[model samples]
Target: MKKSTLTQDNIWMKEPEEHDFPAAQDYLELLLVPDAAKKIVEDLKKAPTIIKKSKDILRASRLPLLPETNIHVKENLKKVQKNKKLSPILLMRGQNDLIIADGYHRLCCSYYLTEDMDVPCRLV
Candidate 1:
């Protein structure tokens, strides 16, 4: 599959200068079904795995990432490429958006590596 044009430089990839934990929390509350939200949080508290899914599917979702965060992702990607296990991305099934609660940078990095990459994620 062709790679998505979406990247750190993309307009949709813009993020607040400061990490907005509260806003993210509020958005989750607003977007998720109560039980589903709770289940994800609970799952986060437990073990997470690197489940591979198509990068094209994720690109269609149109979730954004922080450019600054991408720097870290690049560094981590090097380690991942070297056989290190990075944490699973936290995703939420929202009514209108495929919300990425965490690990947008990792997703972007994986996209950079290969468009058809079976990117790893922890879906809720």
Candidate 2:
């Protein structure tokens, strides 16, 4: 698909979608025990949203950015072209670096728009 030009503004919903918590829990379960993962997901549900720059998030998380050609990233970029509001990211603080838990694709997609973009997220 041809990509759409994206800006940092109005690209995200004020809060994450309800399904995000479950997805986060699923990912966290891999790194942590199921009980621990569940608790983190619970905490994230109640956590207030905060903004972090795309660059800062990637640096803090120490995660590789998926290329724009990634299927998920490409699909999200298409959503942005249609002005669809994407759910905010869900994150957590791991033992050392930050953990994305969910929304990795969203972060990478936003980075392509501009690393200076402020991404809405709830970090636990």
Candidate 3:
């Protein structure tokens, strides 16, 4: 089967400024979801081995995720009223695209809280 690659037009493919992981971690700490670490683990295990979803493939094309994406997330959250319940972590395989570094809680929460399933992400 020919894989459907991410196109440039995808809104999530927009370029982002450098992410400061330390700062992001600090923010995550403040957000402090209960069982944050464990959830990350479970989320990863739950994620599929062959993740063919176009949304996730688009996310991977961006390479390292941008840190300045929080602003976008806030806006997206307000717009979305229904969560899509997607996988939190998607492994980056085949041609060095991108992978879910961490932060499954933030992704899940952003989708649930804002209802926008297409949030910007970063790779580890």
In terms of lDDT, the best-performing candidate is 2
* Colliding pairs, model 1: none
TM-score of model 2 (CA atoms) = 0.93
lDDT (CA) per prediction: 0.53, 0.89, 0.37
RMSD of each: 9.4, 2.6, 13.3
- Kindly list the per-residue Cα lDDT of model 2 for residues 1-124, writing each as its tens digit: 1334444456888999999999999999999999999999999999999999999999999999998999999999888878887788999997889999899999998888788888999999
Higher-lDDT candidate of 1 and 3: 1
Q: How does model 1 score by TM-score?
A: 0.54
Model 3 spans > 4 angstroms off: 1-99
Please give the lDDT score at residue 46 for candidate 2. Answer: 96
Q: Write the per-residue lDDT of candidate 3 for residues 1-124, one digit (tens) a residue.
A: 0113222223232322224233334444454454653354344444433313334544555543323346654543333323222223333233555434444333433433323334543332
**Order of candidates by lDDT, top first?**
2, 1, 3
lDDT of 1 by residue, 1-124 (tens): 1235322222122222223333344556776776766566666444344455537536556855434346676776665545544444666666676777766676676656555555545555
Model 1 misplacement above 4 A: 1-39, 43-54, 64-69
| RMSD over all Cα atoms, model 2 | 2.6
